[model samples]
Target: MDGSDQGLECLRLLNEIIADFDELLKEDRFRGIDKIKTVGSTYMAVVGLIPEYKIQPNDPNSVRRHMTALIEYVKAMRHSLQEINSHSYNNFMLRVGKSAFN
Candidate 1:
């Protein structure tokens, strides 16, 4: 979205990327191609992996914890984005200490 942040022109282009993201997620295109999603714009992106606490059963407690962690991660990403590249432009990563299950 940083490109979108560049100006109105970039913003126009963002519509396409956002649309693509929506499609990818909706169609489960990333199911087999599952990878960490990273956004240059902190305002967008669903993050929160590396479950510190083992996820178990179908309890709301696990949901709450995961949501909390995701929220924190989102906030931190936003903050970092604001700090790093207001002048230039922005960028997630890696596949370690993690497993893929879907």
Candidate 2:
């Protein structure tokens, strides 16, 4: 295999990873999460961006729900990566960082 072949294989693996992540967002449990974009291999996503999913100012439960969803999404992504690694020769490591913005 030449340089171009290796590059194509990398891109193919990346596409498969991204597709798996995108599919997770389509699930009912993750409906409130939005896929902002992908920067290289980093997957960017936001929770409670949608009006319906927004956290209420006075409701602690609402905030809890939003945070829970975000955490769940992260867990799901990590799990997906593990599954991907198990099937492929590549071993992907996931690092997650979360923030809240008004």
Candidate 3:
């Protein structure tokens, strides 16, 4: 494939990956987290950015719960991506980073 073809193919693959992530994130286990945006291969999400989180910001317990939820969501996301890449033998790996705002 030419460079243009390869770029399009990469985008197509990324779209498929994003679709899978979208479906998985819809599960009840991922509530309160929202998809921010996808930049190239990077996927970003925000936790405690919803209405429920507005009331949770002042509570330490709520902060801890949000942290736990974020961690669990990352774990599931990595697992989901692993499963999807394994099928195509692409050996694709996903790295996660987390930041909390006060």
- Highest TM-score: give the candidate number: 2
User: TM-score of every model?
Assistant: 0.36, 0.92, 0.82
Rank by TM-score, highest first: 2, 3, 1
Cα-based lDDT at residue 66, candidate 1 = 56
**lDDT-superior candidate, 1 or 3:** 3
Q: Rate the local accuracy (lDDT) of all candidates.
A: 0.43, 0.88, 0.81
> Candidate 1, residues 1-102: lDDT per residue as tens digits?
465466875555454444444444333322222225546432233323335444444887766665565544444434444443443354321112333455
Q: Among all windows of ten consecutive residues in candidate 1, which has the lowest summed lDDT?
A: 26-35
Q: What is the lDDT of candidate 3?
A: 0.81
lDDT (tens digit, per residue) of candidate 2 on 1-102: 999999998898889999999999898988888899999998899887888887787999987887898899889988998998898867889888877686
lDDT of 3 by residue, 1-102 (tens): 789998887787788888887887788877878899999888988888888664275699987887788888888878877887887667778888877676
Clashing pairs in 3: none
* Candidate closest to the true structure, highest lDDT: 2
Any runs in candidate 3 off by more than 4 Å, and if so which?
A: 1-5
The residue ranges of model 1 lying beyond 4 angstroms of the native Cα positions read: 1-52, 87-101
